[model samples]
Target: MFDVAPTELLLVAVVALLVIGPKDLPRAMHFVGKWVGKARGVARQFRSGMDTMIREAELAEMEKQWAAENERIMREHPPAPSLSAPEAESADGADMHDLPPLMVAQPDIRPEPVAAEAPVSEVEEPKTRGQGEHPL
Candidate 1:
């Protein structure tokens, strides 16, 4: 599982035989294999524990940030000043029926000056040459 190919394993076995002698090499190899397995298991357990702790920390941080953001939003835009419908609806909203009388503007009914007229034409029709003569 260490990703060591067959050639690498053979090389390690040869080295172990040379270093520890053929008589003791088998015992050394057995102990070494067990130790590697234990090391891998410990590593996996540690990595999983770290992953769990990190996720928990991230969740807690997000919750805190959300709480802070909500508090800020509330401070920025407190509930609008409440008024009765008759007091709040102005004539500016044409669709509103319960508008307050005080919101209406006074109408200006003064007469405006009339617009000037352009000169009129007396002729009823204009004349044109016939195209049957020739192409110019």
Candidate 2:
């Protein structure tokens, strides 16, 4: 991503060594290298996790879209039983049971609660106390 060449990196390293004197130059370079490596590792791990989560989310969305599309297609072109087109009706011995497993849904049908014409309460007889029962 930096697009930095090898020559440019060497030049920068020389400048750093010159700026940081001979006594502390090696130590400073070591520390900088370690920090850079750590930063790169952390960024790589974070990007990997982000990519995995993004792919999983995309897959879930795709499945939802596919399911919606399938439902739309199923609604648009319903399975209709053909009676006069082919083998079900052309022969002299026609099979009346040859029917496709499809029919129009009853739009007027509704799930209504069934009402009973009787009361729900029932009579109960008083019970006698047991041998170990205590009276309140």
On a 0 to 100 scale, what is the lDDT of residue 5 in model 1? 92
lDDT of each: 0.85, 0.87
Full-model lDDT, candidate 2: 0.87
Report per-prediction Cα RMSD to one decimal: 13.5, 14.6
- Quick one: best TM-score, which candidate? 2
Q: Candidate 2's residue-wise lDDT over 6-95, tens digit each?
A: 999999878987899889988997999999999999999999999999999999999999999999998999878776655455266767
Report the error of model 1 at residue 109, Å.
64
> Which residue pairs overlap in candidate 1's backbone?
none
Candidate 2, clashing residue pairs?
none
Give the runs in model 2 whose Cα sits over 4 Å from its true position: 76-136
Backbone clash numbers for all candidates listed: 0, 0
lDDT of model 1 at position 88: 39
The 10-residue segment of model 2 with minimum total lDDT is 83-92
